[model samples]
Target: MSLPPWISEQLPENGRVNTKLTQRHVVETMYQSDRPFFSLQQIQQRLKPDVSKVTVRNRLDDLEDRGIVATDPLADSLTLYYIDHPESEWPLSPAGERALNRESAETGNPFREFLQHPLVNRVFREELLRSIAWAAIGLFGWAILVSSSGQLPATIWTVVGLPILTWASLTVGTIGVRLMTGNNLRVQSTEGLDTISLGGVVLGGFWAVFLIVVLDWSPLVTSGLYLFVTATYLVFYKRVIRPRFDASVED
Candidate 1:
């Protein structure tokens, strides 16, 4: 295919030749025979002495800045670069090809551009880090209560029940942020209200469970508190809290 109009007009003979050659080198190195993406470092390594890692990154950045390449970064922040246009001319993964064709037909970008915002990305990162801490502290405290209370399903409750729920929220949120923001905010506001709220709920749940098993509080008191706390989480989870985190990047 012919070079794009701007690329042809602005770049010189030697520079144009070198760029095309480099682009080919990058493309060939990044092509995964079986999948849609590769790590930026892996692509850099493939180039060896031909180019430095920073140079490879800079080149990739230039291509992206020029709108010649598309980058899809995964949960861990490793990027997968692909040629965005000329889908038929470039190697396309089944998924990549489908996304391109659909976008080409849809007459709009489905996810929106806000996903690329840097602040949103930082918030997501902070949020995820806070979430891990919250979950860890929560699970540790809950496990202590369950073990101390002589509760039923010791293994299940401690091993699967509490921790799994916490992690599931984290994993799902990570994906949800990416889908919404197109950027990884990964920031956690940690506002006093949020901190107090999250801590209160987890602690309340733990104590409520403890009261039921160890303190022998009346079923009305024990069960009511547990149910109340659970309901508290459910109501806010779907509404007040989640929207704040929508499209953030937290790992």
Candidate 2:
């Protein structure tokens, strides 16, 4: 294989990529590190002043579009990025393979370490699909209630309530899951927890609301249950979910 033409284009000869140090620093770090893949946020840690993760991600997406990088979307919506070069020395055509191979030899498996998550694989499949699933579940559950008929005939309440709850929960869950997954991919690639955070507490609270207020729920009851469940979730989150997740990642 040959080096993709765009690869040569993205990394212009020294002194040409003027104006920004962070973008240049990112490229240099990738060359120096032996990781098959890295996240925009993970790459940010190598910077001196420490730019925001959002900027890093935009740069990454730009690099990918320019054919200087490639991404493998992982569980929980995290994307793993690596330099793009075709096979050359490895009987392929590119030099990027060398970096990836050296990374694996030192780091062990890359992909396997990416899949572990409380959110699961389906969540990462696509944002749209996950939304649809939550909508379906919510709608179906409420329809069931409506069919039963009762006081205030909340049958409509659930049919309406569940979907509304699912939509809200799905939004928060997607954000949390996506961030967590990205960090996981980063750890697996870079060998540490430089990218992941433990703020699923916000999401746990969001999910707790969904559970408590689907139907036949008073505000007091909803608030009470939300706090109880949120605390329980936080406990499991810090202890069970987060740890198991990190344990699955490398170093």
- Of the candidates shown, which would achieve the greatest TM-score relative to the real structure? 2
Question: Candidate 2, which segments miss by more than 4 Å at Cα?
Answer: 1-6, 12-22, 88-96, 99-251
lDDT of 2 at 64: 66
- What TM-score does model 1 achieve against the real structure? 0.27
**lDDT of every predicted structure (CA atoms):** 0.59, 0.56
Report the number of backbone clashes for model 1: 29
Residue-wise lDDT of candidate 2 within 10-99, one digit each (tens)?
543232212344344565576567665676667878765546777777767666676666777776767777766554321222245566
The backbone clash count of each candidate, in order, is: 29, 11
Which 10-residue span in candidate 2 carries the lowest summed lDDT? 185-194
Candidate 1 local lDDT, 50-119, one digit each (tens)? 6776778777776677666678877686777766555454547857755765675487453553343343
Model 2 RMSD, rounded to 1 decimal: 15.7
Cα shift from native, residue 89, model 1 (Å):
14
lDDT of 1 at 114: 39
Stretches off by above 4 angstroms in model 1 are 1-21, 31-35, 75-77, 86-91, 94-251
- The CA lDDT at 157 in model 2 is 54
